[model samples]
Target: METKNITGLTEFILTGLTHQPEWQVPLFLLFWMIYLITIVGNFGLIALICNDPHLHIPMYLFLGNLAFVDTWLSSTVTPKMLLNFFAMSKECKIQFFSFAICVTTECFLLATMAFDRYVAICKPLLYPVIMTNRLCIWLLVLSFLGGLFHAIIHNAFLLRLTFCNSIIVHHFYCDIIPLFKISCTDPTINFLMVFIFAGSIQTFTISIVLVSYTLVLFTILKKKSLQGIRKAFSTCGAHLLSVSLYYGPLLFMYVLPGSAQENDQNMMDSLFYTVIIPFLSPIIYSLRNKKVIDSLTKMLKRNV
Candidate 1:
């Protein structure tokens, strides 16, 4: 077995979204606009929840945290990608540690949001007591701590590996999958760690959300009044939509192996989670949420 301390590759060439020169400008503009919308929408959501007294419930509390996470989650990858697209040089240097931190933070933050939902829907009466301000702060703190811990472990392991081969990455950003592919050393530990950490987080969070929604559906069905059921479903529809989009691409990318599609297809699927999902989340959640809509309307009226 050959052991090397560090690889010769100091920088990496990212393949980005496309190879065609003609499409670069158009794609750059599109992603730039999407990124802008993502920032403004998520920022607006956080601000609204913080400023509005009526929106201080457990549900909007989670939404506020989600907005905060989305801000960084999108920022972690998209800005670099957009810059690379527009810039004369497409190659960039990404610190393995920073990439790991952002990704790990996103994963845990998402799981925490799911837990918030579980508490709110599964136990409505006790929701306030269970997800109190103190508890919510603790949850957020723990999620960040957990993310930092996981990122440190992953990055430590990655930094130990040598990458003497080609420094070009097939994806837009410093994703774990692409990182693993370029590794010149044994990646068993890295693979196992990713499988264990990522799999456990996704599975556990999705299971909780699934179970909570199941109970919610049962409760709604048991209600005799059609109007009551309709209203209840309406309340949950936004969450359900957001959860599905967030989890669907994740499950596809992380849970399953890469054999399902070629590299191009895989990149497209990855885009769903990275770009599309982030953009869709605010739109779906805000549009489906009556409270947010009303809050926005009031804000707009005040401005007008």
Candidate 2:
């Protein structure tokens, strides 16, 4: 095994969204529109939070990071998929190193955002003190660092693998699942690595979020005014929506065993996380946020 020559795979053939020739154009247009909206919505949210003074709280700070992550996350897979949709033949080479970087970064960013919410809700009195500007900046830096660390390890393992035969990946992008399917060597170690790292991150983050929300609920229930409880719940509504969208498809895709039917089902679920969720996240956050609406209204009034 040590003496085996590691030759770089030249190209990979992506099984585009659908095999049907008739569906190509329609699917292309639909995802193209979604990609455009995702970029605009996420960037708009980031700009709104950055430029507006009133939106400088920990919540909005986290929202801005989420927007930034969503922007890159969608960019990583959608553009390539869109281009493939328009192509006559779906052949592409995903630089494994580049893909490893993208996926790892996204995972860390999601975990960081979960921790931000935990701090904001669980320690409201000390939120400002605990999540100072310096601290937030450090958190962002650490998130990226965590991604870099994981990506290095993942890519290193991938580089060691010898792929001499199949190069066709049956997915829209360079995800680990599809990539593992094409590996010529035994993938038990690779599968275990993904299970340990990805699974641990998801489980730990979800636990923190659940604990934070549980405490928040208990606190809200203690308030005498129903209006206060309602208001608090409304504030958290968008976060809950985001959490569900992100975790739901993730659990479905990663936790379950891949079967013949799972391929198509997984692709659709991948669309939910990669396309629909990113596009909807900013809109959900903005619409549910009273401050964002007020700020936008004031800006429009001043411009008019």
* Native-structure RMSD, model 2: 3.3
- Candidate 1 C-alpha lDDT tens digits along 98-179: 5455555556556566566656655679877888889878877877777678777766666656775467788777666776
Once fitted onto the true fold, the runs of candidate 2 whose alpha carbons sit more than 4 angstroms away are 1-6, 88-122, 256-261
* CA lDDT of each prediction against the hidden true structure: 0.73, 0.73
Clashing pairs in 1: none
Over the full model, what C-alpha lDDT does candidate 1 score relative to the true structure? Answer: 0.73
User: How well does candidate 1 match the true structure in TM-score terms?
Assistant: 0.89
Question: For model 1, how many clashes?
Answer: 0
RMSD of 1: 2.9
Candidate 2 overall Cα lDDT vs. reference? 0.73
RMSD of each: 2.9, 3.3
Off by over 4 Å in 1: 1-10, 86-122, 258-260
TM-score of each: 0.89, 0.89
